[model samples]
Target: MANYINPMEPEIKYNIALLYFNEGRDEDAIKILKECIKLKDNIIKYHRTLGVVYLTNGKHDEGIKEVRTAFKLNENDILTLNNAGCYYAIYTNDLHRAYYNLKKAADGITSNTDEYTKNVIKKNYNDIKLVINKIEKGKPNDSIKVPDLRLLY
Candidate 1:
């Protein structure tokens, strides 16, 4: 007998990983997502999911690196920009870069963006605006946490 593989196998695995992630099975999701990346490293969604998994699982640096890789692969990708913004804002406390990337993503929204994604970008942009306002007022925003960008997926 010959082994058979479906071209959509990676996508299938990616979706399964997503289900696992949403169910709070981070380790299982991570494993499947890593396998998906190994199969199709160019898919930004896989990297994004994996990066979020790493970040939420206390592997901040690794998560940032993976998200950065996705950004490098496609800077104009709304999802990548959103993730980059959230990562910088939340983990690194780099408000400037966060605002820039988030603003870019919000402004770059086109017809290709689904209504849900457009809404997510808008909400994130508004959230960042509030943060910027608070920062400008010398108000401590240490209590404000970045919204999970993964939820937009």
Candidate 2:
């Protein structure tokens, strides 16, 4: 069997990737995520996050591939579905993929959590739901007159 390192080491690398991402250095973020992948090959979060970084940098196909790989590791992840949907909607403009992911996200069951598991509830889920509602209901005719609710949160 391969030797095991502390999982936290790879987690730290993942955090560094997020820092680089926030600094607007997408290339650096990708590098750190890749390193994290080698260290913790089974960590799906690293793959998904790296895919998002790629998407932000306009590497749509690569981003989709990476996120899909992550999903293969964990098929029940709502975040991955949302990320894939956003990539399809915003980057590829592939309404079909967007619809599929958004539908999955909207219908997926989530665990109920108490105080100790508070991380279960996040706004991203809500955001995806809103987008799905928009698509299903059709856009407002006066799009410009509508509020930019995206910045609301």
Measured by TM-score, the strongest candidate is 1
How many clashes in each candidate? 0, 0
Report lDDT (CA) for all predictions. Answer: 0.83, 0.67
lDDT of 1 at 144: 60
Q: What's the TM for model 1?
A: 0.84
List, residue by residue over 49-73, the lDDT tens digit for candidate 1.
Answer: 7998898888998898888888878
lDDT of 2 by residue, 105-136 (tens): 54564564333212222343455455556766
For residue 138, model 2's alpha carbon misses the true position, in angstroms, by 8.2
Listed per candidate, the RMSD to the true structure in angstroms reads: 3.5, 6.2
Tell me each candidate's TM-score.
0.84, 0.67
